[model samples]
Target: MVFGFLKKRRREEIRAQPFPAEWLAIIERNVPMYARLSEADRDELLRRVLVFVDEKNFEGAGGLEMTDEVRVTIAAQACILLLRLDDDDYYPALKSIVVYPAAYTVPRKESEGGIVREDDAVHLGESWGHGAVVLSWTSARRGAADPRDGKNVILHEFAHQLDQEDGAADGTPELDRLAFYAPWARVLSEHYLALRTAARTGRKTLLDQYGATNEAEFFAVASECFFERPVQLRTRHPELYDELARYYGQDPAEGSASA
Candidate 1:
């Protein structure tokens, strides 16, 4: 017990260190919205991000070197998700982040009836429950330029980490003591169905139809939209807005909107 206590203490001490000013400035320069965070909040995010970068294993793809710029670019976006929430909890499950130079082929091998073949799948980003986040530098940078479009690779995958917390990305997590799961169910269900309908009808949707794939994707995609474009989401789907507001303990429209 004493050993465990000391280990936890050390973790907290690591989490309290100051992030380099130059690193903070780099993120702020690339991601304008990152500048909006309050000084204290900035410090806290830096603290977590600093440790997050160090703790994770990052490898370069296509000959790109792993540099502070690359890690900070990705960490800053991941930090966005943690800005309003505690750094502990579900996301702690992720221990490593692998960054590629650009979208690359993730090959999967399979056999059919007595034959075997390998298929190369092209991907920009992928998150695994085994505690790794794989991202493309190009896609990551694009997501940084504008967090309002809901296509943030970091936010999308991190939201999946949140969804996977309760052992499955089933579009739900452990809520606060006062959280109302019923409303969450109702709102998410409605929007999810709407997204499905749009996909079925081949119509463009406010929330990406990728959300229609499953309950978990719906939750993650909705989270991207929730933080990225809350006003639009709330105006179009007020019920979902209310539900997410209660769920995340945030009114993103408060911090991100221009009145």
Candidate 2:
């Protein structure tokens, strides 16, 4: 009760502060999906954005200085994932966001059966299960600037954060009820295998081919397509689209068509 009260008070304080005109302009100029939201949803998104920006620590990495534009842009897209949900926990497990100037490389080591391979792989963004999200500021800005491209580093990484909330990032987030799990598993598994088949067969698919890599990657990639190209997602993969709509509590198909 005390924590809820404190959170309510903090939300009130955040709402009481005036949203900067410059930030509004930046959102309008950069995020096309902002214009597609209904008036009430827009208000809710703004509220969530304010809370997200206030609660999370933004750290600079790779000589990238954190700015209001960087923070707000990243927060806005992340908050969109939570727009229809309740309880402003804001990915309680996530504590900080680290921003890089551009694509960054991290060393990787993996063992298969008995062999271990080591190499460095370039990444645009990554979400750690522990407490951090790392992103490339350049990729983030481009994703925000072109919301219709169906590729967003922020959305992809944050979707991983959501998936990790249940102590696993195995393509499933916390659903509304235990009963929903069966259907989620069925739909996701079927589509995931289909995507893998499409990838191997050189067939065109609506969801990103990268999704075929793994269940977790599939969820994140599907989320990007769900928000950015809902119409195409619905037209091509209606079952997957419906499942996402149920999970998100938002029908983005109309918004995408109108936009």
Candidate 3:
């Protein structure tokens, strides 16, 4: 009971702050899906965003200056994933968000059966197991601007954070019920294999071919497609889409005509 009261008090305190008009304008102009939410969901999202901005540290990288626009933009997208979630402990492990001015190059290591190769590669975003998410500001803004492209770096990275909540990024997040895990594993495994085949055969698929790289990447890329291309995902991969819809508790396609 004490914990519940504290949580409620914290939420009330966060919600008591005035949501900036400019931030609301940013959401209105940038996040297309924000306009599709019902009034109640929108209010909830705003509350979550407020709490998220209060909790997470935002740091600028590569000569970028963190601003309210950047913070709120990223927070709103991250909170979108939490909108229908049951708990308010949004990303308990995520503590910091690092934003770069543009696509940043990072050192990469590849191992194929004990042969190791090192190189530098440009990436839009990355999520770390130790509770930090790195994103390219340009990609993040563009992703918010165009919501139906099925290529949201913010969603993709935050999905990785969710995948890591269980201390591993194995494509399966913590589920509400034990039984839900069985179907989640079954459906995602089937689709992951199909994506691998599609990637090898050079066949077009609803999900990004990057998903075929690994199970963890599959979940992240699938999450991007789930939110950004829901109707198409539902049409092409109904069972996989159903699993995601069940977990998220929101049918974005049903809410948006364009989706």
Which candidate leads in TM-score? 2
Q: For every candidate structure, what is the RMSD over all alpha carbons to the true structure, in angstroms?
A: 2.7, 1.5, 2.0
Give a tens-digit lDDT track for model 1, residues 1-259.
9976875676688787766888877787777656556667667777778766766677887777899888888877777777766546327688878888899898889999999999898998888988888888898888878867867777888888877776877898656654577778878898899899999999988898899999988988898898788888889999998878876766778666642
The residue pairs found clashing in candidate 2 are none
lDDT of 2: 0.91
State which candidate, 1 or 2, has the greater lDDT.
2
lDDT of 1 at 77: 71
Candidates in order, TM-scores: namely 0.88, 0.95, 0.94
- Whole-model lDDT for model 3 versus the true structure? 0.91
Which regions of candidate 1 are displaced past 4 Å? 87-90, 108-118
TM-score ranking from best candidate downward: 2, 3, 1
The lowest-lDDT stretch of 10 consecutive residues in candidate 1 is 83-92
- Predicted candidate 2 versus true structure: per-residue lDDT over 82-102, tens digit per residue: 988664689999999999999
Listed per model in order, the count of residue pairs whose N, CA or C atoms clash below 3 Å is 0, 0, 0
Off by over 4 Å in 2: 111-117
